[model samples]
Target: MIRALAVVLFALLLAGCSPQVETDQARLCRMALPALMADGAAIDILAETPDPDGRGLAVAFSARPSGPVPERHLAACRFREPGRPRESRDLIGLTLDGEALGEARLFALVRYWLATPEGRAADPAPLGDLTRAPVLSRRAAYALQMALDGLPLAAIYALLAAAYSLIYGLIGRINFAFGELAAAGGYGAAMTALALAGLPPAPLLAAAFVMAAAVALGWGFATARCVFIPLRRARGQQTLVATVGLAIFLQELLRVAQGDRASWMTPVLNQPFALARSGDFVAAATPMTFVASGVALGVALALVVVFRWTRAGREWRAYADDPLGAELLGVSPSATTARAFALSGALAGLAGAIMTASYGAVGYALSATLTLKALAAAVVGGIGSLPGAFLGGLVIGAAEAGWSAVFPIDDRDLAVYALLIVFIALRPSGLLGSRDPVVEGLRQSRS
Candidate 1:
């Protein structure tokens, strides 16, 4: 494993040395083209015309038909001038290369040329009137492409799900501080990456993974030992209260330490790569940091496997089945709980770190809401079922993404939460999750 990791790190280093293209525009184009093409009245065309400078082609599109058109399509595009590739300006005036036309212009020209009276007579067809001017710019298509890739959305959901699932599986209690732990992991790894900027991408990834794992483990262990353990010993609702207190305390600490200043993970190792190409549209490259979710999932699985098969795992299962019997067998409940806390905490930390880097920012205030949602996901997955937690995370994540995609729900903070309530009402045990022990116990005792 070490050797393979080393090779990957080395390859990343070599890859990083190569130049990366600015991807924002390319990504946008990918999204715009397909959507534009889908419109009944929308035209799919590209045109290149001349520019005075002659270094690059001057691109422009025609305005779409005006007034109320039955078609719900509106074209949007942007163009960048020479020497300012990063800065996009409106594509005004004439087309460059004097040959290829911007999508809008090409569509317009096609309509005009094809619909000319004499030309129509040659083909024997009546031409429709042009209404709205094409509203698309070169920049618009590029922006569209970025949105369509859905990678950023994917990364966000993946992180949230992983964190919730890991915590729910090992701790058997929602950790309010899970988001903070994720923040810590991300900030910690990001800082480390910044410090080791000279390292290759693979090494940077490895380093971030290791740092995140360490931080998560430490945080989970400390929280469980110092807080949850005491509460569990006392037993009952006290545990829940203590967790809440700990969560608030940690959030405040993070706020004080970092302030409201946005914290971000270093993407020094990230390089842009094209995802797809269709005509003039292309998906931009994104930092590979988002891929860290895979690592998180793998670690989560390893933990589950270890819990299921290892000697320690067997002991844990035995304790869960019969605490007094396990104690008679010489297994220490305190020790096992401590171990579980450590494992859960570490997973949380790793998730936080992955998310921070993936999203590019972390704040103390962000914890409460995310944690609550994670809890919802956990419950939805089915408490005590590790696999269920993972599945639940995906469902929640996907639902959240799909909702955002289809509707403008930004103002509705409770929308996602409301969905959670619905899930609980509809499937109390969660899609694949099992019932809480208390409920199960009551049923068994009654039986």
Candidate 2:
């Protein structure tokens, strides 16, 4: 495992190095450095030449004061000289102990790069040995830093994905408006906290969090009653279209109401949670997260209690199995469907509120995209499985955050869709979707 990891690290290191075909310093001098450095200005490379053909030598590329430095001329500058006495010259040494380089030593190297009559010939030689120490040291430090930072980012993604997976499993469809719900919850809590600016942290946080969660739950109830129930009863392609339309409408309404502006959901308990390995990456759970978690737990507990202990729970299970039969026995399918929608929406709103706090801002136009991602999470985790929805969300969140940190890949939106497609191909029924008996029947019938 260690060897494999070492190989991967080596490959990444090689990738970061300047490509052999074209020198980075040449490009910088011709286009970049001239803009910053006055003519005759010189800078030392902290390390040896990165070029394979011109390794082992300290590189110094400087230009004479004047017009644009031609690319061909810049490229032709010599890298380092060969077989120089590494011990005697002290040409490659750096002062680490706050000891400054004497004027004579600095002038000697500067004059060398200018290649004036005062300095030696600008010969392109591989570095001797002293240059290698700092080069390897700096690279090792950078790689270590990245590895440490990456661990928590990965953990954050896992957490969010798990939360989304739970939501998808229960809802059976992506709540396109889910992100907004989280955003709203977060913003509402933040705003409330701001209103009570002088209050103690505990009470202020509680008040804001409660308001956010309550608002989300209310919205969830309304969506179930006003949008989802009617559409589900219609039980046609129009139902899907209608839900999508509602999502669009909600997003537009929020945009228009807010005048299409950016807003921040400021932190309540602004204290940072520090990690030992990476002191830089500090985060604290927002009030919204606490509210959402409470809501999630309460709902789960309610489901367990109702299902295991109550008459209503047994009837609901029967309804799920056979709606027509349950209705004939006087269990109302309409009521059950309405309840499901309310639950799904409420949880989604809670999540949205949390996101608002996490991001520290919210915008109207982002709702539809949020829904799409939530759906992707649900699908990836296993559609109609609550645990799966939560897991899916975390996976997507982590993947997105992690990729941006380590890679220079573009178009994150495209990556999410690609991931969804791969998941579908690998597990068509989703994480918890049942195998289609009808598909088998059709095959048998055809055979």
lDDT leader? 1
Task: Provide C-alpha RMSD values for all models, in order.
Answer: 12.7, 17.8
Worst 10 residues of 1 by lDDT: 123-132
- Supply candidate 2's per-residue lDDT for 372: 70
TM-scores vs. true structure, each candidate? 0.64, 0.55
Which number leads on TM-score? 1
Q: Ten-residue segment with the worst summed lDDT in candidate 2?
A: 70-79
Across 308-350, the per-residue lDDT of candidate 2 in tens digits comes to 6887667656665555567799987567756555555555545
Model 1, 1-447: lDDT tens per residue? 999999998876676544332232222222233322323333322332323342233212232344344223223333443211332222222232243346676454334443344322331101111122133455664554545334433334444555555444444455667767766666677777667644445666677768876876788788867886666545445666777888888878878987877776544424343444444444444455346546646765786789788988887677665666778999987788778767666666666665665665677777776677667767777756666666666666666655665567683346667877988789878777665675355323321
Off by over 4 Å in 1: 1-172, 268-272, 277-290, 409-413, 435-439, 442-447
| Per-residue lDDT value at 70 in model 2 | 27
